[model samples]
Target: MMRNLMRIEIYDTTLRDGTQAENFNISVDDKLRIAQELDTLGVDFIEGGWPGSNPVTIEFFNRIGEIDLKHSKIVAFGSTRHIKNRPEEDANLQALLAAKTPAIIIFGKSWDIHATDALNISLEENLQIIEDSLAYLRPHVEHLFYDAEHFFDGFKNNEEYALKTVASAIAGGAERIVLCDTNGGTLPHEIPPIIKRVKEFVAGLSETVGLGIHPHNDSDSAVANALMAASSGVEQIQGTMNGFGERCGNANLTSIIPALVFKMGFDCGVKEHISRLYGCSRLVTELANLPHNHYQPYVGKSAFAHKGGIHVSAVKRNPLTYEHIAPELVGNSRRILLSDQAGRANILFKAKEWGIHIRPDDPILPAIIKELKELENLGYQYEAAEASFELIMRKLLGLRRNYFSFQGFRVTDNKYRMDKPPLTEATIRLSVGGVEVHTAAGGDGPVNALDSAIRKALIRFYPILEEMELVDFKVRVLSGEYGTEAKVRVLIESRDGEESWGTVGVSVNIIEASWQALIDSITYKLMKEEKK
Candidate 1:
């Protein structure tokens, strides 16, 4: 598709609407960090929060006000004036003014159901609320945007009343009249025509106002709906970072911005900073301590991951054969995933990417492939355990270090009474630089005990191991057919002060699997230090 010449304004409401998500939470400091990131990404506007809603929100506006954003205009969000109060007297309107932002977005009911059933107000009163609320704030702020909440549903139900609400906002001086999919159930096919009708309706009134789209992801079509709106000539697109919001989410700007620029050919403010999208997406989820969706469309971990042999070979020859857009265009890199499904092509690509020199005819290539396939047959997965895969590569390439040799290890768990917690202990004997070391440690569990004992045994030779800490441990039963005797795969994430890596192990015995993963974790850490 050809790129559209028209520019679209990007507005992020992550601070306000994003916080409505159940699992997502951030501090005032976090909010400031995110705002700076959004500005760096070249978003047109950032809705800081409603100042009068809470103490944290007010503090957010005050603290963020001190930052000199490079491009984004900070916007404060709130609702229209109360039905019973004048615009000047409304607390929400007063809070929007208190935020002291250059732009403010206020939403009012457009759905007749929300007006009558939710707000218990007449349709006429709602229109007055929309008109007066915007008119009062129009002169106070540099830019005033009005959001018609539940606009799509309202238009479908009562076309006249919905058009009237938008007209009233335009009459009262809303620079941009945003149509919102508040219920988030509107389909993509339903958007363009409605926007066209809206444009025609405004044309008949002999008035023109900026058009905007704010969609939620309840039906999993927010991205599609947003694109439809843009194609229909909307100037502004409102969404949250990583689609964070109350229910499903606000439209995912992370996905939308790139799509608009690359796929749909729409010019957006974020076009220059498009390469930072992946890092920006991760930053938000990281701050919220939420697991990033690995399969998310644009900014996911596996967005460009290749597993099948045919795909790997084809992608190596021509990435366009498998990928829609270049991964680097969005700050993401292609991943040659190592697993049972991987082919020789996958290995070659991974070897080159990881800076491991290898020839297509190298004898070790076949050996490594055989070993990986054998391991996978035994229920080991190397995709998420890159450290383990790296170790295998080093071993096959003769780059491995013999930091320590394990002699033996034993772990015991004792629980004599129901009232008493189990006591776990581990003993390890190993040789470092030909020096035999014996260590014993106690922990909350057997894995922890073994980890402590092994670290105690090796800390003498590789003192740098002291800087390494285990961050996460995950165990999965590879097969449930055998139930208690099923093979288990263990992945251990380890990190030093600077870097992190994951190691994998598989065994029928859980303790053995954990032990294997732990050993690889330490080995990778030591190897990295030695190389430096």
Candidate 2:
């Protein structure tokens, strides 16, 4: 028997729900950039924000409409007509139509709580809200999607009434009906029969009017819910890029789409443009100026990173044995995290990445690894802080890189000439590759002055740091210590050319801790560049 392909439609709502996350705000320029990216990612639909919700979103959809989106259909999203206004007369509906996009999505309350509290409408009135709005948009657009907000819990609590609401929208000519897990509490197992009953309850309409699933991740079940719905023959799936939303966030289309196309064997046209997904994911995070989650499933920093000796050894032999998928398949690079847990094979890979070669039987490989472990046991962690790890490798190689190093440094903790002035004066005497050099700098504290002095000295040799800024610097006292005098570790994150790298250091003195991190930061960048 010849096999039939399962083709599913993907609707991306990153610009809308993604912006709803706390502390995230995207500019119109950023919105346009995301639109262009999603377009290139080959999504079936790109839901720009509601046209009448705000001027920024309105202008964004309009501006984006002018740009040609090759394979994606631009969609305008909004709520149903106002309680008192007619759908034809409502300004929001008219604004959605004015957006000039090909499709429109309108959301309405399906739960009794939202109906009574949020919408302040009786059950009958809310059903009309969904029906009338869909009927009004049907004449203007070919694809009109209706979102039954909180549909699952609504169905579970009051099955008859919830299905009645969906029936109303479908009867009013909604091309696709999407059941939303607004609270994201529904389970994967529960979804199969729920979708089956809903499809069966609708009778002959399932084929004429397609089914869709839009889930949130409050219970971290958005992906599972969407996956289960697809198994039940849902034709469309809606979600945001990185699960960014109001509370626990919308489903991460970044994750769901990959699993659907790659694992589930759904012919979503997703693999044809898989390379753009990584860049798109990073672009949205950068536009929001947020730190991308390092463990974010497939695209995260440590997604493909291997650190343990046995695992690293197996991965080198054949990555597919341990890795579910090749990272390059999704435009991501494989990173082997280096820490005390690493073995000789791990060191070999790291050295190879840095353009050095070391045999597995080399005495220094095991000895240096042991030394690194001893340092870590003394509370130095090189996982998040890779710069210090690089320095350890370089020192063990006895390869004196043609670069500068600190010769001497001193700190004076006292009140300055002004009693209110910052209370630290740090003096430093350092050299670049053993060339005698000295400098003293001022800062609010010793750590600040020490870092400033190091960067200032290095500017004379490798001045690229003038533009490369330290985006964030963090420190932690290992939980084992109870006294004030206990040693602490520091993690420094530095960014250059839109790329960032992390490194670590440890010391008893806070200043010493910060200095170790500072030195590692400079060395890692220099060494990383020299290889390139």
Candidate 3:
């Protein structure tokens, strides 16, 4: 007997439903860029925003035609005709046609309460609008899809009425009828049986129509429900990148695509480009200006990271012993995190990565691990400050060269007027190649003044320091018992046009902590330049 294999459709709504998330807003150009990325990733459909909603979405539809998409079809999303207006006179329906997309998807009320309470229309009239709206757009578009909004809830409350609405969609002319878990309350176990009944109902009407699923992540089961629907024979799966959507989120296509391709053996258009999954997920988060979830499956920084001694040793021998899939399959790499829990295996791995030579029985290896543990106990973290850790290793091996020496620094904050801000000034004395230099500068804050003073003192000696810039600075208090006098940790991120590096320091005084991190940052930049 031949095995059953399904060709699943990958429909992405990141530009539409994804924007409904709070603080997740993008401009028209951002949407175009994301759409192009989705097209390049080989998604089957890219649902553009509702053309009737706002001027930005309207401009998107108008301008999107300029880009040539290779693998994806542009889809315009909207709602069914209003009960008060005819199908031809409805503004929402008219805008969908005006968008000129090859595919269109419109949603209608399926739950009885939504029709009676939300729409303020009888259940029978609600069915009429669903049929008439799709019937009107069916002849105009190459592919027409109907979304039975709140479909799972509708089936649970009034199964008969929900089926009536679905029947009306088939009576009209929908190529695909997508059942939606709009409120996202439905669990995974509830999906297959409900879809089975719908399949039977559709079979009774016509055998040509296909089924699709749109699930949200309110219950954190959106991906599970979508997978269940696919196993139960739904032809299309609708979701967004990184699970971004209204309320909690939509189904995460990043996780679902790999599951379908590798675990379930389903064919999808994006299967050939699956290695771009991590980059695609990260690009969406970067464009949104949101922090990436390091714990997110398949694409997060910590997803494939090994920290424990036993785990690292096992993985170094055979990755399948600890990992579910190869991280490279999804454009991600394995990370060996350095911490108090790390052992000799972790040290050797990082040594090789940094091109530092050390044997498995080298005497300096144990010393490095001991110093690392002591620093971590003092609240020093090397995970984000690999430059500091690398410097430590090079110094232990007598391979590091000192570019400059720090003598002393002074910072003062003075406020003269009540309404005006305080004036901060920093003075630094340092020596480069046995030559002494002293400088002073004013800035918006104490750290800024100190940074300015140090740069002023060093730039003339090491002209390359002019290209180095501080990109980000973060501080964390290690203890709260002393409150204002607590020990603090500072992390400084610096970039010099080619790459960025992080350095860290810990001290009881915030300025001292910042100064330590600043020195490490400069040292790392100088070392990188010397290597180049």
Candidate 4:
């Protein structure tokens, strides 16, 4: 006997609904790039945007029309015919046609209140709006999807009217009736029974009309609701990448797609390409200039990271003992965090993974372990400074070069007037290959000045250092009791075009901490080049 695999459609609205998120906006080029990425990820549909909303949306539709998307159909989004206008005369409806996409998705009011108050039209007139809008686009497009706005609340308040709204859409040849939780407050447990009732009601309307779900994340139940909806036999699941949308956000497809395929035994079409999930999620967040939610499930940096001693040891011995699934299954790698809680197992695993061969009984292992603990006690966190950790490991293994020796450096800050910003300057003296070098430079701040001076002094011996740049710097106070005199830990992130690395230093002096971190950053860069 064969199992029946549920075939689910993934309709992504990252380009449309995602941009509605506060502090989350993408350019036209960003939209095109995301469309191509979704196509490569095997999404069934990509809702471009509301073509008639603004110039940005119109430009997205115009530009995307020129590209040939591989797997996903470009969907132009819009609203139903206005109460005061005909379908052809409505600007929104005409813009959907102008988009020239293979599919069109238009939303209309389903709730009696939204129709009577929001659209300021009679409830009966709203039904005509849904029917006429879908009917007008049905003949022109290969697929037509009608979104029932505020669908769940509509069903709860006026079940008969919501059913009638979906019936009108089906009557006008809508291929799919998408139930939208526009406010995103619907509970997960409420989904299954509600969908069951809708299925029973729609059965009498049309046998071929499919059901889809569009949920927001206001109450953080959007993902749960979407999964429940899919399990309850909704043919289509609509969401945005990384859950970026209005209010809290839309359903996070990064989380949903994996759950549906790996856990629930559903066929979401992207099972083969699901390994790209992490990269896809990060790319969207990166393009939007938003910090990736490190705590996000499935794709977050901390998702599979083990921090406790017992957990790390168990994960090292048998990953499945502590992990729900192999991190690689979602294109993410398992990370055993090294900190105060780290045991010998953590060091052993990290050494082997970094390609530094070390036996369980290696003499240097004990020394490295002792040094790591001492450093961590001083508030040096290696978890975020893996490059520094790796460099220390390599040094213990005798595989690291001296690179260059730091001598001394001085930084000065001066401000002549209250309105004037402080001017920072630094002078560095260092030895490279037994040659003495001295350099001076100015920067916006003390750290930047120190970094410039160091780079100037070392660039002659190691010309490759010119390619490296400090991308991020963060400072944290380990002990706040001292206030201005508190011990600080500095973590510096550097990128050398091909890859990025993090290094750390801790001290009571902020400048000294920064200088230590900067030195380690350069040393790690040299070490990586040597290994390569």
Candidate 5:
């Protein structure tokens, strides 16, 4: 298929629209950091936020000016002037001007129902507000955009009135008129015809103005809709990073960018820096304190993972047979998952990755695969806990050295008073370099106490262990049939200055499971140091 060769502007609303997502909150500093990263990624426009809405947003506008951006134009977003106040007198417009951004965007009611019911105003008066607001700010800003809120629905309900709103925005000097899928109800098939009519309407009125699409993901088709709109001749795409927004989310630019460049053959400012797409996606989620969706498209961990024996074999011989594009194109690497379904190809691929040489015909290869399947049957998931799997592989090959021997450990939690919190303490003994070391420590909980005690026992012998810290801990109950007696699985994520790795442990006793994970985490750190 011939790809669409057009220049499409990339507009990112991650700092503004993305913050509306539940539990996806970030500080002003975080917004600044994200803005810098977006600029580095070469987005054409970064919608800072609704500057008039909150103090944090106002502060963001104030602080963003200090950092000199190289590519993206910082945009301040707001609504049209109020009914009671003139355009210059409206506080929202005033806030946008105060932001002193190179570009400004103001959304106005396009659906006649919103003007009548939501704004409690006549349809004609709404048109006046939309036009006057843009006219007032026309000379002050270098670039001006008018977002016709709910344009798709409004066009469906009252086509004449919706076109009238677009006419108002054009009359007031909007450089770009963006049709918004505010409720995200528009389908991909529904996009082209509407956009075709709107493009005709705009061409009839003015030749210099352009059209843009701002789509939400309520129908899980925002990306599709945006692509369809582009195919239908829209010049710009507006979306948030990782699809973070109110309700479902805005269209995800992370998925949209690569698709546009690699699949659709569109050119944009970020095309040269597209390899940063995966890292940029991870940074946004990390700063928001949210776990990266392993199954997400393009940038997900499992996007290029091969598991089935035939699939792995085929991928090892030729990736294009089973893969769409090179994972490295988006800064992601292929993962050969070592599950029960995985075969020799997966094991050999992993061995090469870890610098462990093993012959394809080695007699021990089948034994290693058998032991891996047995451990998985016993509920050991090696996919997420790769460090533990690596240790097992080394031990089976007789290549692993014993850095420490586990002696014993005890934990106690006592509550002296009803009004006070419980006291938790742990004592641990270990033999390192044939020297026995015993220590005790207290913590906020049993697992924490145990972690502290182990660190105390080992830090003196291996000072490098001090650089390692548990960044994340997750516990999952395997089943509910046995209720409290059911087995629990603990996954711990540890990181030093250089890198991070995951380790997993499972047992009926939660503490024992945690201990097993902790032991693996420490051992992995030591193993890495010894290899270096």
Candidate 6:
């Protein structure tokens, strides 16, 4: 496969659809930060949002113009006229023009179902609507593109009508006609011929129009469909950086761009900054406050990870036999996971990562991993959280730290006066490394009581534990089958004095799980402090 010789436009719409995800929200400052990053990533276009639809976006472009993007052209996305007014006079058009960007991409319905039902307009009127919209935009900017949304389904129902829509956009002075799989239901096999037909359709028109694609993932083939379009001669691809959009989302440019350049040997989007791919994916997810999807293809945490014995053995011998590509090519590291099925190689590999040396067949390693796996089966999952996993491994390896000497402590949760609010009472019997033996008490809930008790038990030896604070605590219901007694798991993230660690615990009792995590948090804090 030949790499694309020409510099292809890298358009990113992460800020628009990426934030639409549930539990995902980023402020305008965050969006602009992302836009600035896109500029760093060498994106040619950054589709901000529909200014007419929301005030946040309206305020976004207002300040976005102030930031100097070295390689990015600001683009605003909008839809066709609102059915009643002429496109030229539409308020949406006024909003588009107010953006003051070099390019404007507008979507108009192409699916027969949408044309009649959603728009409540006739088939011919929809085409005319598209024409009016583009005609309205064409003179406003030299770079105008039309998105023929749901083009695949539209083509399937009325091939000529769909092709005619693209033809009409060309006639309306759209420099590019992007055929969109709006519903995201198109399959990989169905894309080639459809894209081919559209390519031939444009070629016949003898217009210097660029062919483009935008696909959704209702069928999990958005990436494949987009690639199929590219293979069939589409020059431009519009997608969100992390496959973000309504419903199942859009093509994942994070995965597609790298796969296109490294695996398929094509050029698009910051081809040389390959190492930033995973970092970019993570940053966007972080900004959105969305937990990174572990199984997301190519750039996800599990993309090059291996666990099963057979797979690990094979991969250790020949990575190409299993891995699609070297992880480092896309700025991701390969990981080997340990579970019941994990082999000695898996444990040894992980140990090596943290600069701990251990033989694969060491007398104690297999036993340690087996015990760890059993603990995991009992409700502890460390695979997704590495810091806590490493802590467990270190403990099993007899690497222990004694930063402070603790006496004894008692914890009580209020079940009377504050029965609903979870009040806690705790007391500690004390000592430190034989220093200022001072003991004061404080607490909020059961976990807090335990934490305060432990801190009081140790402040005499090491005073830094007082500086440690629990930043976040997450509780996971492991199963519902246990009925009222279902096993629960907890992950505690603690930070203090410029250091952080994650601790995990599991038990049938929810409070017990949190208590176990509290113990680990205190222990980890002590160990790290002592080592320092």
**Please, what is the TM-score per model?**
0.97, 0.92, 0.97, 0.97, 0.98, 0.88
**Superposing all C-alpha atoms, what RMSD in Å does each candidate have to the true structure?**
1.6, 2.7, 1.8, 1.7, 1.2, 3.2
Candidate 1 has an lDDT of: 0.91
Kindly give the stretch of ten consecutive residues in candidate 5 with the minimal lDDT sum: 1-10
Instruction: Name the TM-score of candidate 2.
Output: 0.92
lDDT of 4: 0.90
For model 3, which pairs clash? none
lDDT of 1 by residue, 242-296 (tens): 8999989989998889889998888888999899999999999999999989998
Q: Cα lDDT of all candidates, in order?
A: 0.91, 0.84, 0.93, 0.90, 0.93, 0.79
lDDT of 6 by residue, 13-115 (tens): 7878666655678888889988987788777788999876887898898999999888788998898888799876799888999998888989888777788
Better structure of 4 and 6 per lDDT: 4
lDDT of 2 by residue, 98-163 (tens): 988899999988777788888898989988888988998998996899988999999988888888
- TM-score-wise, the better of 2 and 5 is 5
Worst 10 residues of 1 by lDDT: 201-210
Off by over 4 Å in 3: 1-4
What candidate 1 gets wrong by more than 4 Å, as runs, is 206-208, 415-421
Between prediction 2 and prediction 5, the one with superior lDDT is 5
Candidate 5 lDDT score at position 359: 95
What TM value does model 6 have?
0.88
Can you write out model 4's per-residue Cα lDDT over 1-532, one digit (the tens) per residue? 1233879999999988999999997888888898898898899999998887888888988888788887899999889988889888988889889999999999999899999999899989999989988898998999999998999999999999999998999998998999999999899999999999999988987888889999999999999999999889999999999999988999999999988888887887788899988888998999999999988889999999988878888887789898887889888988888887787889988888889888988888778889899989888999889999988888777788898888899999999788999999999989988999988999989999999999999888889999999999999998654888889999999998899889999999999999999999999888788888
For model 2, the superposed segments whose C-alpha errors exceed 4 Å read 1-4, 112-120, 412-425, 432-435, 464-467, 528-532
Cα deviation in Å at residue 352, candidate 3?
0.6
Best by TM-score: 5
- For candidate 1, list the clashing residue pairs, or say none: 4-265
Candidate 6 local distance difference test against the native: 0.79
